[model samples]
Target: MSIQDTVDEMAPLRPENRHGTDPLMVLNGIRQEFPSSRGRTVHALDGVTLTVERGETLGIVGESGCGKSTLARAALLLRRPTSGEVFFDGKDALSMRGGALRSHRKRAQMVFQDPNDSLDPRYRVQRSVAEPLRAAGVSRADAAERAMAALAQVGVPEDAAWRHPHEFSGGQRQRIAIARAIATEPELVVLDEPTSALDVSIQAQILNLLLELQERQQLTYMFISHNLAVIRHLSHRVAVMYLGRIVEVGPAADVLANPLHPYTTALISAVPEPEATKRERIVLTGDLPSPASRPTGCAFASRCWLATEQCRTEAPPLTTTAMSEPGSGHLVACHRPAEAQEALASGLQLTA
Candidate 1:
């Protein structure tokens, strides 16, 4: 069957698939690809599998074009996957129709980056936040009331609600974006680099605000970013993506402290430390390979220091290694797992 047919078959709002013990959101072998000329395809996401526990923050970090946003869109069901399944609260996430889909919409919302563009410039903050509720059948007066509450929840002053988006600073505008996202009291909010465009100080404020809101509202998050330090602070677990595939995933502390994949290690090493005396950077060679024609064995093999002949000929599946698993699961895709570990320990400086 075609990808669209597969999507149509999965029922995202069924009760049977919604009662998992741990996960509130699950992505099973999800894949997304865009067709290219010459009978090729750009593999944006390849067989990604992960889960989000209720009220947990899961950070997804990767280089640009590694499908971070695409993954987020898949979870939101905004961008249908080319293959695989999404289970939310035990139901197929791709099959809901009409009211079911509409109800589910309130359950999952997205906080986009760039408040300036995300919020309609012409719409006042009150109307912008009220838009979702209005769409869900809320009365105009009631929607306005809910919009004000949402604004307060995100730290916006009451007076600002009547003002246009341009009336506020970038940080306040982002808070407005957050208000719109939470107006419906969504259980899961896919945060797509919500703070990346803000100033450093503002980023911290937004992060703290998100954490506070999550705790207060018991919200689950799929936080996507390229910033390791931000991920370390916000995530309960971290999944590292490279070339559209997750090469390493585990508890945030464990994966950040001892990254398993070569790409992950290189990424972690690039994070600047406060103590200059203790810092040693690992610079990988070459630019990120294009997704249209990925490497045969490992997508990361071209830039991987420990890659061998086997790595070039056989693809590695996401699997557990013998080193030691973190409390939450930590998985890696590499033929020479030990060698990857040795490279991490030796602080091997990658060469071109």
Candidate 2:
């Protein structure tokens, strides 16, 4: 059967839908490597394993070149992984054949970082939004109707839909991009810094729009962003990535309030605070190591002040930490998390 047919058949199944039973989307030991000169490989994603539950928003946060975007592309099977599996709705996503894969593409959609780049200048907002519906085999009449509705849903006016992308503002173009992404009512949406290109005020509007849409349509999101503040607002759980591996994964509240991992603490510290007295800035030292020549142990080890001899010699696997709970589990790939927390409490200046 076609993936769309399969999705239609299984989408009605509520009994099979439970976060604990299995993830709606799963990444198992996935890796993406690019060939470099002199027999070296660029490890964009090094064995990343993640899970997104049904109707849940999972935030992925990391520095640039930390492989979070690559992971998102891998999840959508847009960037083929060098190793491992991508499971979508309990099916082997990577192994999907021909039309099944095409159908899967319809079910999974992406909202890119830049609005200007995503939308075609020549195409009107209505045409851009209707593009997906047309590919989905909807009639031109039905697609046009749906496209206008989508534009309205994303806070664009019915009149704006008739205009070209170049005629609209950045925020408006982004809204149009969002409308196109949700035009087909995708089950999974990968938002890669969807609001980063907009103004601070406009970012909130877009975030609110996304939340409203998710609630209205019961959509699942793999929100990829570097902004912790944005992630905290939109995500139920947050996964912190470094180099190519997940350093920390847990409930947003726990991870933000009491970050166990040193890297997580450093990331959270960088978030700007309104109050001066309460804010403690963590200025990390040096530059992030290149993915092609990652450290032998933890990828964060070179920058991590808490790194011990063991940390340099042995790679820390993401094991179930003590913070794992019923609904939300906190996992940290660090052996010295407790020590790092203690150092933070002692007012130690954390250098990268």
**Per-model TM values vs. the true structure:** 0.91, 0.91
Compared with the true structure, what per-residue lDDT tens digits does model 2 show for residues 1-352? 2223422433312333323455789899999999998999999999998888788788899999999999988899888899999989989999998878877888889999998998989998899999988987889999999998888888887899889999888888998999999988899999999999999999988999999999999999999999998998888778999999998887666666667788888887777766535645677887789999988988888888878899998999886665444444678899787865655565546555
Q: Which pairs in model 2 have colliding backbones? A: 285-352, 303-352
Q: Counting only residues 3 or more apart in sequence or on different chains, how many pairs clash (N, Cα, C under 3 Å) in candidate 1? A: 8
Report the lDDT tens digits of candidate 1 across residue range 1-352.
Answer: 2323432443232222132337988899999999999999999998899988887788999989899999999988898999999988889988888888888888899999899989999998899999999878889999899999999999998999889988889999999999999999999999999999999999989999999999899899999999988887888778999888988887665677666777887887777877645655777888889999888888888887778898898999987778645233778888877765666577555543
Candidate 2 stretches greater than 4 Å from native: 1-22, 323-327, 344-352
lDDT of 1 at 163: 92
Every candidate's lDDT? 0.84, 0.83
- Steric collisions counted per model: 8, 2
Clashing residue pairs in candidate 1 are 11-92, 12-92, 12-93, 17-90, 17-91, 18-89, 18-90, 18-91
